[model samples]
Target: MTRSTGVVVIGGGQSGLAAGYHLRRSGIEHVILDAQTAPGGAWQHTWESLRLFSPAAYSSLPGRFMPAQDGQVYPDAAHAVSYLADYEKRYELPVQRGVRVSAVRRDGGHLRVETDSGDWRARAVISATGTWTRPFLPAVPGRRDFRGRQLHTVQYVSPAEFVGRRVIVVGGGNSGAQIAADLAHAGTDLTWVTQRPPRYLPDDIDGRALFDAATARRKALDAGSTDTGGVAHLGDIVAVPPVRAARDAGLLHAKPMFTRLTPTGAEWADGTTVEVDAVMWCTGFRPALAHLAALRLRGARGHIATVGTRAVDEPRLHLLGYGDWTGPASATLIGVGRPARDAAREIAGLLGS
Candidate 1:
């Protein structure tokens, strides 16, 4: 069965919710298709020990603020999940849970979204599927031969599992620093392997600074200027209390990425080897656009060709929360709001015209 709507939002995560907020304001008839049985998108799956690098205020949706509970400086994963779940209910967003979208194809003038349960037909489609399920691991020599357990950042839960075990955490992003800190605090042996030293913001600042800087950059770019400078490199590690404490204890140092993985551990480029029981890959993620493969809009970089969130090849389509490629900081909770809002406006305009 196919139901018609003004727009069909793919993924009911932060970005999808943000889009829904604006689309509802515009009185656009839209349906949000989510694969998860629950409301919190990726937040529900994050590890127990995981907390936002910033405070609750810095990480929030569009209309409502994530209230700080128990004066917790940074909200934990459960806190975030609860907030997201409540936000959906409070907004009365039209979300269909456990509806896995298998593919989306252009049917002449409209788009048809194929799902496990049913199909969705809409005048416009906004693909908000984030990168949580598509964790990326770099190809290394002898990676398949490594016998030690290899896990992505998504599979990681807590430091308790690594206690008394030597583990190598790879990646220079916030996840690598945060996870390594968690394990080190628990007395677990950890080796931080990164392509370069991880950069950290001042202990005083958090994601707010990055958000402001990105806003400024977007304004500047829109005004046809290239000079967008304030807080540079927003994706760098934020010196949250835990990470700061880890740095003070001299546990945040990083080694150059190893050349290859051995059965027992990893081998460095300079003839050095480190034996580890597990390799935690905190590398990164690619775009979760597999369902859109049938549309043939993806480019060589595994990203859809988007003309500022709108698919360049498909006029009735837009993608949100992919990464900087879609918009500056589009993957962040607060950051996705602007892109989502703009996408909604564009979709409304197209459906009206």
Candidate 2:
């Protein structure tokens, strides 16, 4: 079956929801296509111990503020899930769950979104399928030869199974630091590994500050100014409560990334080695854009070149919430709103709605 809509939103997660909210506000008829059977997007898949970098109030979508979590300075994964699920219901966004988009192709003057359930003919398509599905694990020589258990951030639920195991956590990003802290708190024999020394944001700095800085940078760039002081001058990881506590306790120290993996452990270039029972890869993810492959929009940098949120090659398509390329910090709950609103406005303008 084929359905028609003014706009088609792929992925009903935070980015998709943000776009939906703005599109709805703009009086655009749209359908949100979500591969998941439920709401909450990537938040639902994160580990149980995961916490937001800021308070619930700061980490929210466009129209509504997330309610504070009881006695928690930073909300947990469950709280985020609850908020996202409720947001979908409260907004009455036209979300079709369990509908996985396979490919999108040009259909005359419209875009044809192919899915397992059906196809959609949309005047404009917003690809908001964020990076969660494409968890990245770097290829190190002898990685395949490792006999111990290996897991990615996406597959991890909690530290229950790994409580007593000797684990090596790799990656220098927030996920790596956060997961390492979770394992350390669980009393696991943990070895945190990074390509370089981990850089942490100030204790007072959080998502809000980062977003503000990004906004300033965007404004500066818009004004044709070169001095855009942004997050680049700051640290990589946010010092959330848990991460801060872990760092204070001297538990989150990281080792240099190993040169290769052996049968039972990792080996460093300096001939140092650690025998670990498991390897936890918190590397990160690339944008989940395989569905748009048929459109052939990806460029040499492995991303579709864009002017703001709209694809340069295909103005009929907009990419949301992938990262800074779409908008300044558009991956975050609060950050995605601006780009989403702008995208909706552009679509409405194009459609003469």
Candidate 3:
């Protein structure tokens, strides 16, 4: 049976939840289809020690604040998972877990949302499948031939797996820096690699500052002023306590990108080879938009042409939480709400019309 809905939201992650929050408030008939069997979305898949650099109060969705537990100021992955689950219950959101959306196509005036379980015809569709499931591994020469283990950030769980082993952590983003620190603390011999110089936010600043700076930069750009007064880039590392400790121990340093991979490990441009047991590729992720390939909305670099969060080529669709390109820092816990709420309001208006 093709169920008819006002809006069909894909992915029940933070972004999707935020969309649902606004949709419910707007009295729109919507259902969120999540691929995961549980409520936590990608947070449940994050590494054991992963945490939000912001305080609990700042890391909230649209309507509810993320409550701190046991005097914990900054929430961890588990807290985020539980909070999201509770948020859904609190809002009475219509989220259907374990229903992986297969594709979204035009059904006359509505969208035919094809999934494994059933089909939904929605007036508008919100794609909020975050980057966690689509970790990117840079194609280095000889990487395929490397005999040692090569794992992407998606596969990374804990540093205990690399204990007593030589490991190379690639990329200078938050994931690479955090993984490097965790592995070092676990007694793993590690080398850090980055495409360029690593940028770090000041110790006092956190995700809140990052969001504020990004918002200012976005506003300036909109006003034809790209001069964003030395604000920290969103990708820059936040000095969380553990990361600070690693910086103090001199383990937070990164070298230039290696040239290629060897059977044992990686080779540098100068022919210096480091034999390592594993390579942790923290390069980052692309949006999980494979299902939407049929829409033909994506442009170069696999990004869809978006005006705000709405896809330009397909006006009925909105892509949320991919990154700043979709909406300023929309992939973060606090950031997702902005784009999601905007998209929800837009969807509601569209459905009403």
Per-model C-alpha lDDT, please? 0.87, 0.92, 0.86
Residue-level error in angstroms, candidate 3, position 165: 0.8
Compare the candidates by TM-score and give the number of the best one: 2
lDDT of 2 by residue, 264-295 (tens): 99999999999999999999899999998999
Point out where model 2 deviates above 4 Å: 227-229
Candidate 2 structure, TM-score to reference: 0.97
Indicate the worst ten consecutive residues by lDDT in candidate 2.
227-236
Worst 10 residues of 1 by lDDT: 227-236
lDDT of 1: 0.87
Those runs of model 3 whose alpha carbons end farther than 4 Å from true positions after fitting are 227-235
122: Cα error in model 1, Å: 0.6
The deviation in Å at residue 70 for candidate 3 is 2.6
Comparing 1 and 3 by lDDT, which wins?
1
